[model samples]
Target: MAAIAALSQNERTLRYVIDLPISSTEYNIWKPLFKLFLSVKDDESTICGRILQSLTRRESDNSQISSYWSSMLENGLLSTLIQIFSLSKNDDALTSAFLIFLNLLNEVPQIKNDLDTIKNCFSSMLKHTRSTNNQILTLLGRVLSCLSTDKLLIDSMVEQGLIETLMILIDKQRSSQIIYPYFDCLANVIGKSYEYQRKFIYSKNFLLLIVRSYLQDYDLNLSLSVIRFIRQLVKNNEELQNILAHYGVCEHLLGALSASSKELQQVSIEAIQALSHKNQKVQQILLREHALEQLLNLLERTNMSTLQVAIVCTLWTLCENNPLQKRDVATKIGVRKLISFYTIKSDEHLLVVTDAINELAKCAASINMNIQEEINHAQGIPYLIRLLKSDNEMLVLSVLKNLQLITCAPGFIANRKNQEIIVKNDGIKLLVALMMHAKCDIIQVESAQSLACIALSNNQCSTLIESTLDFSYSHLVDLMHSNDVNVQLKASNALATFVYNNSRVQLFLKNHYQFSFDYFQKFLQNNNESIRCITAFQVVVFCGLINEQKQSVNTAVGCGILMDILRTSQIDDAKSAAAECVARLAHMKSGVPQAIIAVNVIDYLCNLFSSSNDTTIGNASVALGFLSHIPEGRRKLLNRSQTSSIRYFKVLSNNIERSRAAPLSDYEKEQSSTNIMNFYLPNIRQKV
Candidate 1:
């Protein structure tokens, strides 16, 4: 059998396997061809690849070969194969062994306990790593890889110290033939436990070792391999940051930030971004090291791919922590450079440009020194306005959010002259259209935020913003309960800001007709912290109407439910807002507060006067003051001993003391403009 196997493996017959007829009964004639492969005299990789290729292709559905192979293995054939696999010096023998194992392992349970005997055959081969022949290790690694996904098989191999062996191979000096098999082994083991892989790769001290080796390595190929491994580590932000924090990575990364190769700079910047997010110390270190300037420089000169990645990372690290970071970027550059960069670049380059612009808008929210100046100078608003018509979901989101912020900036309204710029070029209508048409939750949430920003300036903007309020209410309400936490926060913010004005509130109630008070009632009882908190607050604000026209019986009943949500256990802001609504309702008409008491709202307001969270506390005070304005509301409070009003007054007094004592960050001051305009706008506009 060995001599016949040897006879068929000579150079002349390899062509025959490729040319063999699909139906040839001679297929079985090649069943023992692997034994011939084990004896071949060959140095060519192609011969090895070809023989394995023929075996794999033929073995595809060849159950006869499988059965025959199984019968051969069931006898003493396993020992001769083990001897050939161990003793053969030719790559062809190793390739044949790999193919045979691949076929056999597919029917792994058939090998059953005998599989251990076969695997034991490998214990001797692994010892051959000490030999000058590394192909044995490579081939063994490949054989193990084929079985790596089988938990039972891998667990057995691991018990025999296979992971330690594979790591040694991986940690060895680079050899082209050895590296691929090591990567394959790594991929297999990582697939076993991603967390375990991450721990080793991103360990605080070990990551520096990898980065230092990568930086000092003279070989570009080796450097790229190390980078690819590090890139996997960067996927875990906290892990990557913790690793980066162990060294002066900010300066190290900033030095490399300007590498002429775009790929190198991208990887370095990504690692820095990951680090910043992982540790606030990294962020402070970056800030101290002028990391933002280096990043901005990178943004200015970076290629499209690099710039997009840099912008995204910068935004994630900077804007995620403080809206002020976004504001600073906007105020410094005015978004003119960034917007013009996007406008002039080809559509293919637009993605990176869009990322920069989106981050700029988020940071710049209503903070530009001259909103109109920046918008006009960059030609930013018009380009973004046009993007409202874009088919791409992300583009629409970017455009909408920036435009929202731009339109909301103080003194952003266009006169007849700037009207073409503001309304036409920037396309306010398209943004309004998105309230109905956008399908993505992010786009919808951002669109709502945009609408809120646009409504910030004046009654004119409000009238236009109010037109979309019904559509906004429908989606905003749904998103307030979204599974995505960010969407829920953003939508809650949008509703709180936009719904504050009487025009939008009236428009939403009348048109969108928030008839499903029951849905909101259920949401208020939800276990989600943000949902319950924001929903409680927003429902109360919704109930308080300044110029609210009389509602139909159904709308009035919905209003009663709003009062109930406020009066429920742990009403917090909801209770305070409900009390304010009772005041507004009674003052608007006597019938409203009478209807509110029917829902038992006074007890709820009394409970919230002592609540934490400045919003609930302040609203409670204001609600008590408003209640003191209404005869029946005042009587209800007085009948409850008037201590509710006194407690609220105390809460208000304490809030003022805290406000005076607590200093705001630049971002806080920046964010304050939005809150100020949101809550105190009508009075401020009236005074103006």
Candidate 2:
């Protein structure tokens, strides 16, 4: 301690303390000793002239000295040093205080709670921001950067017209390089106040000041820092959406996209991307200016992880809103070239690849169509198929969804051999794997939908039914029991289509898929209305579409289930679906009409006459009209108890008798009698 204090007094031995361990308590004892060595604090020696000699000693030793200085900054000593720091007039002493302060603030909990005290001290420092020594201003800038997030300190700085002062220091050609720290602090403070962007934007001239400073200075770090603030300012302020319409900031930022510093180029790219959000005019300008080419050039040269992330994000934005731009860009830089970048081994790069692929997949469906010929020439399917097995679940799901979109379009999967290639390459296996094992229900549902689409292709349709009917039927039943409503809805829809297209599928349903009907009924009881509606609708579709030729007996039971749906809950739509399903089944040769009449179809149809929804009433009326086509249904309608207060039947009979028609189409006569039956019938609430 004595040795460093003596050196500080002479300016010769001070260099030695730079090598001493600053983190150790023993070495930190010298911090108190500096109070006596700082004679220049009272003298008029050129601040830099007095400080340069000692700074030289520590120039190559910032780490060791920073550590030792930080160890001395616990609690009481920090306050005493702040007091001494306030009294120093020499720029050298001010610069040294900040250097030591930076180290002290780096200790998290120490300054976290002391922000108020620190802000008060900083207020005193800014009073001399115009100190003739540029070094002092620069040191103060560094101190401000460390404390920029502190609200009180920022307000204090803002009160002093510090923005103009920092703008002066940002002029690197004439300003000292030390001013970069000040620029950093200024940028960070601006970034924190996004919610107040309007207040800040309208109240201050920060944009003009930064743009002018950037034009003159052109420092990569400073320009990048300012660009980040611009990003934040625009992000939190919707009013700034039209910035490019007025200010030339967009042009300067585009120019910066070509900067030599990869970091600066990325910041510029990110700023441009942020500006382009929902601003088609800004995107058009960038596109017209060929800014994308500039970004791509940077992507090709830089392999830095952050740069790649920014580049991917930029490309993703351009691609999502404007597919023509992506297709055009893909024409110049082949899709494979862009996708192959993900093959880079770094985990960071892989994370970026995952994000990029997810974004790209949103546009992938569009791209696959526009570039199908070109992709076929390049064999793009193989690349897409490879991503299906990627360890990343999200990436796999995204790729699967895009591939499905490609296959879903008309005539895209026409070739039987090309369709088989997916199965042969285990693509179907992967879809099945996702259906069974993927952790996310959304992914599983998407995969299941994709499989159904693939099975729809004429080339693969019948064969897919024959080979996988048993397992797929069972799987669909199990997925119907899934807690995920989307999964159950999709799985049920797929199963309906399967049973409709293949009569043989009905045997499996009878033998192996019986559990599905019970679960389907449970789904109808789900609290989510969409789930209940769709589940009931799907069960109706399956029963209505079933093939009586292959499994007549089970089809009879399916018909009874449809009738039970109506009787259990005359929820207008469920009743309508039940009625529609009955109409379809009655036309079948399976004696489903006998089953329907036995379930009291006449009473169920009359209950729907009071339904307020026109469609529900119309559907129930239409189904009753179909049942009236049968002789036995007419007998059941007239067999009701004479004493029954059938309000609806009375209305129908009066309407029919008033019309004076001895003869009526079975449809009209049945509708008339059902309406009359409804008037005499008491309102009945059926419980599922």
Candidate 3:
């Protein structure tokens, strides 16, 4: 019985080794064929082709064939095969040899060392491409496609004018089988290499050829290949995208969205996305082509998650910074569809979905209040708030940012409702938790920023935030001491916004959490310019919200720190913030004005009146106005040497006149202008 088993195994091995139609698990069965091919002395023997066919089959059978590569190279099998390819006239022999070479290029890492020997065969392949045999042309194109993977071989192919040859063949070849391989080869050669890209672009009518080929093709496979080529060609190349847009490539890509094949539609969508990225001309062209209408239709019809994601991404690129398109998307209920992406629970899908929602929210927040309302009415808020519990930090950050945009865009009056919705959903608790306990500093910082946005000018949200069990003023104060400057800045800003004009919350913090000016001194003197700027602004908010009689808080954030900022800080925003803080302190009238005057801040304040920053100039005028209220500040202002006190007063008075004429409403400007006219000018006139 053992002898019979051995006999059966031997028969199977002979069948596999002799190129019969059989299979075996025996290792290195192709070695016997390699030995037979090597023993053949005649270069014209058909045995070479047979052995090459066996090798190709073995390579396909096992991808882990690199173990035999060293022995094959030692036996000069690759050189011998290339020799047969160059000299053979039989199409079968040529096709077999080309397949083996293609396989070698893919599998053997050591093949790159022998690139010069292989490069000598490109001329022979180019010659055979002119043959009327479709099989020869297809195999030649495949061989070139495989060779195009290496930079050295790509340079060789370009130097030998393979691109020009392939383009010529593409123009002449009417067979889709032949043309598909040529397009594949060209795409491979031009894969992200700037030199090849430039050559393709500069070539006369090359892009036109590609667009025409893609738009006119009937075969789905050929169209897919050409569109993929177009995708690769336009990736990150805005110049090529614009040129192709002029050639009507975008219109054709949009037309492809209606294809029956899902794969063709997917590739076509990807191609359109690559073309329209950051290219406003292409984006406008796509919009005019009814891209939004078709994409929305596809989004509704496609159950394939990847295709849906691609369609959503294409919509995002088209609508980015294009308000006309965004408004159009909103008109079509596109925001509702975008909100639906949150239902997908895969982290990959959620990350993309959250990013799209965030960007759409940002765009809508800037110009369209109705869109923000649309997102809210679509139940976007609860979906976003629920994502806050995700273990993925990036997804949470994206949701937080989207929530912030919805609640705090500058002109978005509907944010009041969004803020209320967030609070209703317990988003405040989740945000506070992230701000206090998230491991990533960026997440912590973004969480704090989102919280600040929620609390901005909304007393209801502020009240809820102040009462959340896990949240406290101490948490914010602790975050302020973080080693990261951004963390410190964001935490300080959140604290300030939490307390801004919310006197109840402010009182609660002071009475329960020991919130004081002492917590801010370190930030006031921080070397980071942004920290100093935001810290000073926080102090401004703190002083403005408190009673004027709280001199200890006013004096604790010393006039000298602000004076030093005005004297030494280079950033105009920081200087403006510092000046504003000084104005807040001086308005207290608890001898802080005299202290500012005593510190000689009057000279710095007067000097800042001529600054380039409008905020700085306005805040400086207000600080001087407050200083002029006190008798001591009045004496110092009227005694300046370089510019007359009356001249400074005239500049202040002119600023007030300009404020009234300016179109935008500035509350600080209105209040300061009123105060200057009502009180400071009378004192200045009496002193003058």
lDDT per model, in order? 0.52, 0.55, 0.68
Model 2 lDDT tens row, 1-688? 4444344465445546545556544454444444443454444223323343244234454444333334334524456446545666766556665655554665443464565545456556666665777766666666777777666556666665666566544543245366566756766666656544554456335556556555346766567667776776666354674653356677788788767787777777788778776677777777777778877777777778677767766765655575446645544555555566655544434443444433333221121132333333445556667677777776676666556544432212222433455666667767777766677776766677667656643435546534652335566667767777667777776666455334455555756544335556666667654355445445544663333323444454555556566667746556655654554444333355666677787777667656654334444544554455466775565555243345445433432232222233233343444534322222341110
Least accurate stretch of 10 residues (summed lDDT) in model 3?
659-668
Q: Give me the overall lDDT of model 1.
A: 0.52
Segments in model 2 whose C-alpha atoms lie over 4 Å from true places: 1-34, 37-41, 44-67, 74-77, 103-121, 147-179, 190-193, 196-199, 293-309, 345-397, 405-409, 412-433, 436-440, 453-688
Q: What local lDDT score does residue 686 receive in model 1, on the 0 to 100 scale?
A: 28
> How would you order the candidates by TM-score, starting with the best?
3, 2, 1
- Give the per-residue Cα lDDT of candidate 3 at 177: 70
Worst 10 residues of 2 by lDDT: 679-688
Top candidate when judged by lDDT against the true structure: 3
Q: By the TM-score metric, which is better: model 1 or model 2?
A: 2
Question: Which ranges in model 1 have alpha carbons more than 4 Å from their true place?
Answer: 1-29, 39-131, 134-163, 170-193, 198-214, 237-240, 247-255, 286-290, 311-326, 329-337, 340-373, 376-400, 411-449, 452-688
Model 1 TM-score relative to the real fold = 0.52
Instruction: Write down the TM-score of every candidate.
Output: 0.52, 0.58, 0.59
User: Mind sharing the TM-score for model 2?
Assistant: 0.58
Per-residue lDDT of 599-620 in model 1, one digit per residue for the tens? 5555665566566544454444
By descending lDDT, how would the candidates be arranged? 3, 2, 1
Clashes of each: 4, 22, 0
- What TM-score should be assigned to candidate 3? 0.59
Which of 2 and 3 is ahead in TM-score? 3
Stretches of candidate 3 off by over 4 Å are: 1-44, 51-76, 87-89, 102-127, 146-165, 334-336, 343-397, 405-443, 452-493, 500-504, 508-688
